[model samples]
Target: MNSMSVWEATANERPKRPVLQGEKTCDVVIVGGGFTGLSVAYHLQQRNVETVVLEKGVVGGGASGRNGGEVLIGYVESMRSLAKKYGRAAARQMFQMSLDSIDLIERIIQEEDIACDFQRNGNLLAAYKPSHLDDLKREQQFLYEAYQFESKIVEKEDLHTELDSSFYHGAFVDERSAIFHPLNYCLGLAKAVERRGGTIYEHSQATKIERVTPDKVIVETHNGRIVAQQVGLFVNAYTTGLHDVIDRAIVPVESIVLATEPLPPALCQQLIKHNRAASDTKRLLYYFRRTADNRMVFGGSGRTASKRDARTLFDKLREGMVTVFPTLKDAKVEYKWSGKVGFTFERIPYIGQLEDGTHFAFGYAGHGAAMSTLLGKLVALNMLNEGDRHNPLDRSRLKPIPFHSQHARAVGIMKYYFKFLDYIS
Candidate 1:
């Protein structure tokens, strides 16, 4: 029962970086060395912009490495839900960008020669109930008719060939997505940034952000400070004690993950025979896949970040795993850990600059791998002014969450409502 995320435990050794010990300067200072910041840095270096990334912990120590590594296409919300919220045109445009983001990941991996076990086996969305299957059918139709996207809907009888489970009513499989070793990818991205003449400081957390002028900002860590013409804050759920307004804009949610010990190859084939990443159609959906080593990496159950009880959540996750695949009842979970991601209203991710002339990108609702990479590139474009500086995903500015202190309670209440909805459906 190790607390280490299977990603970090299995990833290649991350090079040790020195802490910032004195005043340093760069064209852009990026806070948080996770996916977004690294992506921004990587792109900035591509344009030969002097950049420095400061991470509170090691690279990929946050959700960048802790995620389920789905590398999924599109936003967390379905195309229908996105269309209903932001109109069909806007939703379609965003969907295209989301798809492009996956391309960016693939291109980078090939260009950088990063050995992260990158695979394009795609992903599956399973229907836990008959009604859920209907929803999947409608979603599949809407994707093709409205957005010109294609997905295959598997009937209940044929679901087992793909999922090896009789628990699901049906499934929707999208072949455009991918899965990989996220920690390795993050480390590779950092290496790419450095190879392009950028510096990344590990174990150096930005403690204070002081805006000296409209174009000058000073980011201070415990031992040193960074003076930069522009600053980008990519800290997602780990934004606490950085900026109150930015923190309030996001509702931090905990994501618990566990990886079972390597199963027999026969049992592994009895599981995900096609090796596609999968998630169910529940509000608190469980996302899982078979690792390169035949271990089942299953993750789900989000609570407010402040209310992380990994022990209980891990137990529930195991129970859910057994519920879906009874053959895993005796499987031993070798790794268990948890991390956080920003969840915004309407499940829309945000990217914007604050009043003090600092840029930021957050609010991914736990489905941020591709978006973070794309948003980081867009943010870099904003800094370089190469073209349109406007971000389609930006909501102008962040709206401070009302009753911020009671967010945990709100999440708790909503969890129950979602559970009920799952039950009835």
Candidate 2:
């Protein structure tokens, strides 16, 4: 839409609040007000827990607000890779968790009456090469057999109706996936949390942490400090200078997106007939979909925030869109922006307690829209004396990614190189 960027095009706008000053105490302290932290506050407040959330900026001002808004049915990483790393059953469990996360998100939006422009349109996992179909075929079979889900595999000729892209050879359509306005979702969740007695302080940055005991943590922010028995860090990409362990495991991978002007009805119908979102199979991939107002929102990799200029990157994003719909080559791009995504070498979200009393849930690896909120609920439940039965995620073996410090720079370089490979391969 011409209204705003896809991240900002949503109808809901949050009411602002002043930052915290002086000192405050709470039963639990949460740093970062993105989807993860907001979900933590929401769940904790529902249980009548005294909780406070501190954000360096507005709620969902981080990757939670800056993503492509595709709530897909699987992990950010491929299921084949996950099965190789964690075994088949674990991979299946992880996949099930993602599906459950999607359901949980929808439930929260309906129960809270948050108008986030959410839709249940299925996602098309298209294949760019013939070899890529191998993974998709295996995935479709695995999903049906292991997860009891139905997905249709379309051949190359059949893909024309679904995707105008001649590049894709085939695709697997998963009806369980959906899309939504992520920023509005975060804002609505934060407001609900506040309405339930949880306090959220924006522009309040957590600078230092003091472990009062094995079970208590005191978090010091710029203007105030929070003393609590438990603390949570949901700041993923922005975790720089906060914790060395997190900094090493998490690298700030830049993702850029461009929003085109609302297309005419005929063009919109030609682009996506059923209003489904589509993302191709590639290592360094391109994810694009139409918004509620018919504007195309496209996203992919970049180097830096400033270097990824909107004017220049908008052309690049439009090129990808044109590859999907050749007629949209001359489409007008209205807004372009970029945000940092925290990526771990392992590509699995790491949720565990630090040596101190701080409990951390991060490294969603860019598929956090659903998983982050689910993790927030688990984090709150674990902190609120919930039994292991109530906790769905397996956190017992959660550990930080390895080879992160020295290998981080190399990983970035390798990522760009592999992106090029995917582009050519």
Candidate 3:
């Protein structure tokens, strides 16, 4: 069978609907029906809180569907950075929250019967240069000693047997991480939320948000308006013009991905021997892994700043994949696509409230599949009258993006500069 397009790969396969018509009122209104919005609705509905989720497109239609599907542990950046900024104890708690995200994901899949192809194949973080080996070693040591996590190191000679890539000098395998079908997972969450009696409207573009009072927010869609007691803006890259405050703090960069035709069992064995999700240790990097059916799902950004063309980006990704595994030269690429990833200056995610009764979470820094889900649940918990003083992951510690007005020009330039640095280094 031919590989499915990214849109059809693991779509919910539900009938698309037109915009919502009429006025609606809810305890809480969520914008952007991706992982975050779904999680919020799911958890809030479970708590018997009246909630409605509005999406401009279908569930998982945005980056939620376009991601690489790596269910990784930890935040966007290294835990070392967390320790540097906060204390070691705070960093440990933060790291534990990430680890807990993986567990929560697996539990949701099993308990909710989500058919997302979740697997425990683990993740392999490979180092491209010799200098990176020292960093990998330090990372491994830190994971083991400081974080109480275990990772196995693969030397250059052993890496070929495991990954069949000549570009890396060493690699660290974290057995705690996992991978899954991101779109399927997202759709499953949406369905679970619906099953719990929460309403979800697609093609429902939220154009206006007004603060009716200090505790009441009004969300206006094209066809209807929602008088929500509280509002949650889970929108990421698409936050542009929707929320002026969030748009300034988040930078949207393009992330492209491609999939090759299914390979023979022997060929898969020769390539990624363990069928692990693998990514190089670069800021702007390439991440490739074997699928359940033995296809090479490879992805990397282009030489240009943004992912403009699907065909051209796929061609560049094909070259990168072939460079790593020469045997795939004859293989046909079956799927290709791209999506926007939101990032902030700190490289950490932006999760907090605009003010009282308005919660927000975005800017995952290109790692959103699990983090988004986790943050959404936390947001729901925070909304349900939880004690923020005790919980370390409360919304207070995370700050909003700085210089919020200059985000478009400043973030674009920052992304281009980062891409340039990735090219040179």
Candidate 4:
């Protein structure tokens, strides 16, 4: 099987855009042409701003195209933890924004006429341990009491209706959550951006940024330079040497996914009857969902090492899949790939301005599919002075990890800790 992601293999063809040549200028220049950068360009172009997006590779080549495609709600931080850390009101607002982010995706897809298999069949947060069910109950109570959001809890016995696996103790279903073909969504956003006069150049990597004036900066790429009044960095896990502070603040964690060959319709129905995306409660979680074409897309965190053999990773993941669904032991693996995800010490995404006033949003943990799009719009709004009266994420100070160089080691330790917890709990 090829190493390409299933999304790339199945996505519609994207039109090519010219590479940046010589020197050009625009009102705003965005770095990293994934969902975040393209979303920013689309929003800015709506307001008649001359926007340009510079991508290191093709759009969605990064985490955007490689993710599980679950349009989940909330950040990596839980609502209860958010309330405890940053007040109930702040947490409520943040939760509201997450819900709004889901709606925004649907709106964009409909307005742009994107045929990305968008669906709102909802998501299941399965509990791996009995104690984890307690945590889900507490979370459910908080969601109901604080936000009046309703979600159903499925007992272990009834989980068969939602999931075929007997590995889960129970599950919580959030009807508002959704899923879609992420690569097509990225390409659709690019088309919408270009239709609105925003320029997107592929294979044009931004290598350096030189601030010419207080409000103007010049981004130097291999073949061209772009001068803009504002520059926004949305590179996330792929960031390298862009800005010392931003680079140091992010820890790139590798996540790998593998897809099984398409199953029979009856078998697909038996696997996930309702087509809801599902993930378990382990700290090193296992997320799985049914693709539109009836294949099972399963993913999990890879070992903390930067370089890992693809075949070994796929074997481990396949073992995990069999442990969850014994019938899958014989399923033919069709695709295998990995992408780096940006995680911050704070766990929540960061949206702030640099010392020179360049705006940036990154570190989405693993919930970036929806959060990135929302943050991109918010960043554009903040730039236009139309965002919230007080955006906490934009105002927060981002501190790097204490021992940044040992990030991989730290992640390795955390993985072992989680495994231990899974064993004991």
Candidate 5:
């Protein structure tokens, strides 16, 4: 299999923007050109605010462009779990924001005229074990009662209608969840930002962010610097070394993904007839779906701490794909790749402003596609001094993760523990 992302290989052509050359100034300086940063720029331009975005690489080169392309609703944790942890009223607001995030994505796609193969077929959450069927049922009920969103649950007997294989015990399909070409969407957003007179500099990695004063900061790149009233640290997984507070509060883990060569149209239909984006009920979940071009793309949350583990991830992913769809034992994996997901101990995304007047938003864990885009709007509103009291994520500042340096080892131990549990279940 090739060692590259399918999205990168098949994405549409766009003009290459120039790099940062000299010092510049803007009202707001956004670090990282991924979804969050681009979204921040997009929303700021809506209010005609002068903004500058500095990306280390091309736009969407991070998780924003390299994810599973599933525009899902809700957090990584379930609504019931959120309610139990943060009260029902808080959970309801968070759930509503997730729904609104999905709507924002659709609106941006239509308004910007971005053609990234956007589709609303659906997203199926599959049960990996027989006992997990009840969990899916409860989730369906909770979605309907709490959010008024109805999802269809399929039992083992009728599961074949949704999935071709018998690997899953049952499943629930959310009609509102959708999928698209993520990298293209990011590229489209960048263009849209430029069209609105917002400035963007590619190959402009911010190496140091100096808080010159409480009210303003200076973001320095390799070749230039930025003087701004405030800075937004939206780098997500790449936040390490950018700022100590953000890096300490977050843990970044890598997940590998693979895409098979185009298969027969009939075989593709037999694999996933509805073409829904599907993920299983596992601690280290498996996400799989059929591409618009008839390729079976599969991915999993497998940690790669070293170079050796990175090599093994490809094999594990292939084994996983075959186990789910035995018919694909002979299918060729044309592309293999990986990206980092920002995780927090609390298991909830945060949007907070540091003491230096720098605003930030991250720790999506595994769900960042729509949520990252939504955070851009919230952060922008905060930048504009518009009331952000409605934003549930803006309640308080973030606390640092305990033993941040040992997070990798902790995650490795948890992986083995969860693997053992999965084996037992």
Candidate 6:
């Protein structure tokens, strides 16, 4: 089987760009070329700002292309938890931003005329256990009562119309959720950035960032440098010593995904009738969807170490897929790959300026598909000194994760804990 992501295999050819070669200057320099960085660049260019984006690899080489392609709403933390911690009004605003993020994706696709198989068929959150269904019911009610959002709960008996498998007790369907070809979307954004006069350089890894003055910072790449008035760090899970403060605040967890060979159209319909992206209600969750070409794309995270062999992880994921859909036991696996997800201690993404005045945003905790886009736009607005009134992320505190040096072991332990919860519940 191929070790490349299905998105990478099927996506249109990404336009080539030159690597940064020498010293340059721009109004703002962005690190990383994933969704967040690309979105920031796109928005900044719209405002006619001189922006340059530097990527160690090609666009979408990170989690932007490696994700499950579930264009979902809301944060990794539940709405109830957000409300309890940050008051009802603030929680509602955050949730509205999540919804707005989805709208932003649709708007960009329509205005830019991006052909990325964007669809709003909706999303399904399946209940792994009977008790899990109760949680879905409560969540549905909370959304309606508090935020005026509507979602339908599929009873166990009615779930067959939505899914062919009996693995889930029930499910919550959010019609607002959508799905698309993630890599294509990223490439389209890259093109849009260029169309608007923004510059992006691939294979230009930023090695060091030094503040030369109060408003000027020099970003050193392997072969070049950029002097900018402001810098935005959008390197999420790929964060390392490049920015120690932001790196310390994130915990990287590896997630693996596998894709089956294209199945018959009827079989694909049987697997997921409405073709909605779906995920189970588990800490170590399993998310699956039907690709545009009728392939079954399944992804999940488990207790395995990140250093484990790709084939071993593929086998484990295939086992889980077979358990969910017995008829897929003999399905030919075609693609397998993995990427890291960034998680924060609070389980909420943060956006703010660092001590040295470097604007930053990250730590999506596996919900980066939409949140990253929204945060990127907000970061641009923050940079432009506009719309400070509507940005909730600005109020968030970015604290270093406690005991972060042992985060890998901590994630492993949490995986087992979540497994036990899945078993008992």
Candidate 3 stretches with Cα past 4 Å from truth are: 1-7, 10-12, 302-312, 387-425
Per-candidate TM equals: 0.97, 0.93, 0.92, 0.97, 0.97, 0.97
lDDT winner between candidates 3 and 6: 6
Error of 4 at 410 (Å): 1.3
RMSD of 1: 1.7
- Compared with the true structure, what per-residue lDDT tens digits does model 5 show for residues 1-425? 67779999989887788899888988899998888989999999988898999999889989998999988888888898998998889899998898888899999999999988888888899999988889889988988898788889899999889888889998988887788999999999999999998999989999998888776889999999999888999888877488888889889888889999999999999898798888999888899988889999899987776779887888888998999999999999999889999988788898978777778999888789879999988888888888476566772477789899998899889888988888788
Ranking by lDDT: 6, 4, 5, 1, 2, 3
Model 5 clashing residue pairs (backbone): none
Kindly list the per-residue Cα lDDT of model 2 for residues 211-249, writing each as its tens digit: 888667888988889888888888998874777766666
Ranking 1 against 4 by lDDT, winner: 4
Give the range of the ten consecutive residues with the poorest summed lDDT in model 5: 387-396
lDDT of each: 0.87, 0.79, 0.79, 0.89, 0.88, 0.89
TM-score of 5: 0.97
Superposition error at 378 for model 6 (Å): 0.4
How well does model 3 score by local distance difference test?
Answer: 0.79
Over 4 Å off, model 2: 1-4, 9-11, 305-313, 387-403, 406-408
Better by lDDT, candidate 6 or 5: 6
Q: Write the per-residue lDDT of candidate 3 for residues 132-231, one digit (tens) a residue.
A: 7777788788877897788888898888868877877889888878888888898889889988988899989889889888768889987898888898
Q: Write the per-residue lDDT of candidate 1 for residues 1-425, one digit (tens) a residue.
A: 89899998899878999899999999999999998999999999999999999999899999999999988887777889888888887888889988998999999999999988888988899998999899989999999999778899999999888976898899999999888999999999999999999999999999999999888999999999999999988888887579888888888777788999999998998798788878988997899998888899998875533335656677888998998889999999999888886887757788877777788888888668778888899889888876354446876467888887787788889889989998887
- Model 5 alpha-carbon miss at residue 116, Å: 0.7
Per model, how many backbone clashes are there? 0, 0, 0, 0, 0, 0
* lDDT tens per residue, model 6, 1-425: 89899999999878889999999999999999999999999999998999999999999999998898889988877798899998898898899999999999999999998888898999999999899899889999999999889899999999999999999999999998889999999999999999999999999999999999978999998899999999989899898489888888888898989999999999988999999989999877899999999999999994354446656767888999998888798899999888898887777888888678788888888889888888899899888877464456663346788888999888878888888987887
